[model samples]
Target: MAPEPYTIPITVRGYETDSQGHLNQAVYLQYAEHARWTYLQHGGIRQSDLLDKGIGPVALEVTVRYLRELRAGDETEVDCRFVWGEGKTFRIEQQIRRTDGTVAAEVTGVGGLLDLQARKLVADPREYFRALADDPAVFGL
Candidate 1:
């Protein structure tokens, strides 16, 4: 079958919920983070490689729109898509869905590559993204 439009498997923890009885808004950000990392791995950049290479990514901006409340013990899958941008800045749109396949939230992020040592934007890792954009599967191929 062709790749699904989005597929990221993740579990919700009890601590993820707040006194409000639903997931805290911050937790959704955490999920977006987890989804982003998973997406990178699926796209070909491993965290080990980033750490070893002294190259990492940083989020310039993040916007999340919560559509429904997610509770503890819930399992969800995220659907993500790449949005192109200049230089090290790129965008990814992610939709979080409950086990029943209903949307729980939407996350949009503007992120960029960073040279961890200099604490500044770098162009090297962007090449990784550029290559990934061409054919994500090929990274593992």
Candidate 2:
């Protein structure tokens, strides 16, 4: 069976909205990024842990699909799932949904773990992630 996706609740803040009172297009990326970091924390991997190992996560590309407008005070849930593939890169799939289960936006990102010192993508990102996570299975490792 596939592991459950990691999720977190987020409330649209007034400052995040645009002049028209809807969420700003750029804010969608921020929401997706927050979800990804939270997911890593849920798996017991902290940013400090990666820094200690001289490795960090990098996003090579991202695409956002806007479905519904989000206004301030809107309560939403953001979910993140990791799709592992061959080589050094992986796919991150995410969705932002309203309280009533309406999908407001979807985000897809191509990412990789980088070797900070070498300034290059790592050969085996899964191995690095597995070593850092308290429960590797939670991240589909």
Candidate 3:
């Protein structure tokens, strides 16, 4: 079975808007990152834990699709879930939806664990991520 999506509520702030009074494209990435971090933390993986292990998460690629515009003061929810992959590489899908039920943005990203010292991808991923994926076979566990 696939892992269930995790969602967090968000509200657009004044500073996050662009000249047109809509959410800036860059902020969408930040929102996705925030949701990912929150999800990881909830799964028992913290930034310090990764640093202590000399590993850091790195995104290989990301594709974001803008569907609806989000204006300042709009209430939204960001949802994320893991799409398992081989080795240490995995994918994640995230969506930001307005309170009215319209999708504001959708992001699909490929990422992996990096060996900070070696400056290379880590073949053996940490257990926290494996648990997050909820599919041991995908990570060869």
Candidate 4:
């Protein structure tokens, strides 16, 4: 079987919903961001550590497609996976699914490494991030 995408459970809160009683579209990105952080942590890299090295990951673009509605108090899972791109750029695919396994939303994000010191994108990142970019199994090779 192929490797499973990284998943994290999230509970919808009242503050995350809009007047329509459904989760706000903007909140969906927050969920995906959390899952991305957790995924990176699982891979032994932390945002703080990256910042300390004067390098950070930055999202170039993010597209979110809302499917089913998610109301407050609903339990959901966010699944995330990394897709390799040219050089240090890569894509992350995330989905928010209801407890019943129905997809609530899908988020596709493009990102790349940044050199904090130089204040620009880096074509060649350090070994830690480079490893993730080069690993085919990370995206389920």
Candidate with top lDDT is: 2
Off by over 4 Å in 2: none
Model 4: pairs clashing at backbone N, Cα or C within 3 Å: none
lDDT of 1 by residue, 59-133 (tens): 888899989988888899977766655566777788999989899999998877788899987764446664544
Spell out the clash pairs found in candidate 1. none
TM-score between candidate 4 and the true structure: 0.87
- Give lDDT per model, in order: 0.75, 0.95, 0.84, 0.83
Candidate 1 TM-score over all chains jointly? 0.79
Query: Taking the tens digit of each residue's C-alpha lDDT, what string does model 3 give over 7-55?
Result: 8999999999999999999999999999999887766677887888788
Candidate 1 runs further than 4 Å off: 1-6, 130-141
Model 3 misplacement above 4 A? 126-128, 131-141
Clashes of 2: 0
Q: Give per-residue CA lDDT, model 2, range 1-141, as digits (tens).
A: 558889999999999999999999999999999999999999999999999999999999999999999999999999999999989999999999998999999999999999999999999899999999999988888
List candidate 4 segments past 4 Å from native: 130-141
TM-score of each: 0.79, 0.98, 0.88, 0.87
Which of candidates 1 and 4 is the stronger one according to lDDT?
Answer: 4
Count of residue pairs whose backbone atoms collide, per candidate: 0, 0, 0, 0
Residue 56 error, candidate 3, Å:
0.1
